[model samples]
Target: MKAPAISLLAGLLFGAGLAVSGMADPARVRAFLDLFGAWDPMLAFVMAGALMPMTIAWLVQQRMPRPIACEAFDLPGTGLLDAKLLLGAILFGIGWGIGGLCPGPALADLAIAPSEAGIFVVAMLAGMTAHRITRG
Candidate 1:
């Protein structure tokens, strides 16, 4: 119960931050990616802001035995990058560049821009499903 509530709160905060930072806007994100064209640097500030807290959290996690709501610390394995990892990253980058919506921003835009966000989310889920099917 506590863990779920904390997760919900964290998700809500992340969504709110995405919205407030203009990341939920596909146009803004697209603009940010346009380096040779009309590039916007606001996204850099937002990324920096997010990175600070995340870095601190990671540092704190290294010192803590376990999270407040969890019995164990389940960190991702620090393994060498493989072909699958490279392919997944390439796919993710292509999707982000073309759609101007990554998972977080796309999910955040769901309430505000349902039509566009819905399409992206559906496609993303389909891609995930395809990956699972292919991996298995």
Candidate 2:
């Protein structure tokens, strides 16, 4: 019960932050990716702002035995640089560069402007489904 509530609250807060920060805007994100022409630095600043708290959380997490809402941290166990990881990174980079709306912002944008985000969301789901089927 507590975990679910905390998860929901955390998700809502993250979505709200993305929306307020204009990270939910695809055009804005695309502009940020653009380097040679009309590049935007706002996203860089937003990412830097986000990294601050995350850095502190990581430091705190290292000292803690258990998470506040969970028995233990469910973090990734490996730091291995293998084919699967490299392939996934490439795929993610391609998607992010092309769509300019990654999962987080896309999900929030669905609520903010469904019409604009609908295609990307649908495509994203289809990709996920395809991955599941192929992975099996």
Candidate 3:
């Protein structure tokens, strides 16, 4: 199939899987993340289920023939857990904890309330654009 068709199919599958797995539910995620409160571990199990296939695929990729470009995998060069990385992670965690909705969940929430999700998504895209511009 063509690249656009393949990409669209992959996105559809991913969205459907997220919907089926309840990852789109902020309340469910909030409950799962509330370890100190009435802690629910179901999301961990769900994440494990989701990751297993991806993990297997990644392992398989390690043994595959290199692409025609004739270069080794261009993985991230920096392995250091630097201060910037740590700070970014902390900010992300805080946002998730406060909102009970990460990007995917927020996007999925669009199905129920388009205006809110549309605003959030637009703001997110704007932030990304600004970051790229500033960094570049």
What is candidate 3's CA lDDT for residue 93? 85
In candidate 2, what are the lDDT values of residues 1-136, reduced to their tens digit?
A: 9999999999999999999998998889889989988999998999999998999999999999899988888997868798878988899888888888999999999998998789999999999999899983
Tens digits of per-residue lDDT, candidate 3, 1-136, equal: 4556766787778777777777776677788889899877878888899788999977987887763243555556668898868977887787677666678767877886677667767876786787789872
| Every candidate's lDDT | 0.92, 0.91, 0.75
Best by TM-score: 1
For model 1, the stretches where C-alpha displacement exceeds 4 angstroms are none
Error of 3 at 11 (Å): 1.0
Estimated TM-score for each candidate: 0.95, 0.92, 0.79
Query: Candidate 2's C-alpha lDDT?
Result: 0.91
Which tens-of-lDDT digit does each residue in 1-136 have in candidate 1? 9999999999999999899999888898889999999999999999888888899999999999888999998878899999988988998888888999999999999999999899999999998898789884
Cα TM-score of candidate 2: 0.92
Would you list the rank order by lDDT, best first?
1, 2, 3
Candidate 3 collision pairs = none
Q: How many residue pairs clash in model 2?
A: 0
How many steric clashes does model 3 contain? 0
User: What TM value does model 1 have?
Assistant: 0.95
lDDT of 2 at 17: 97
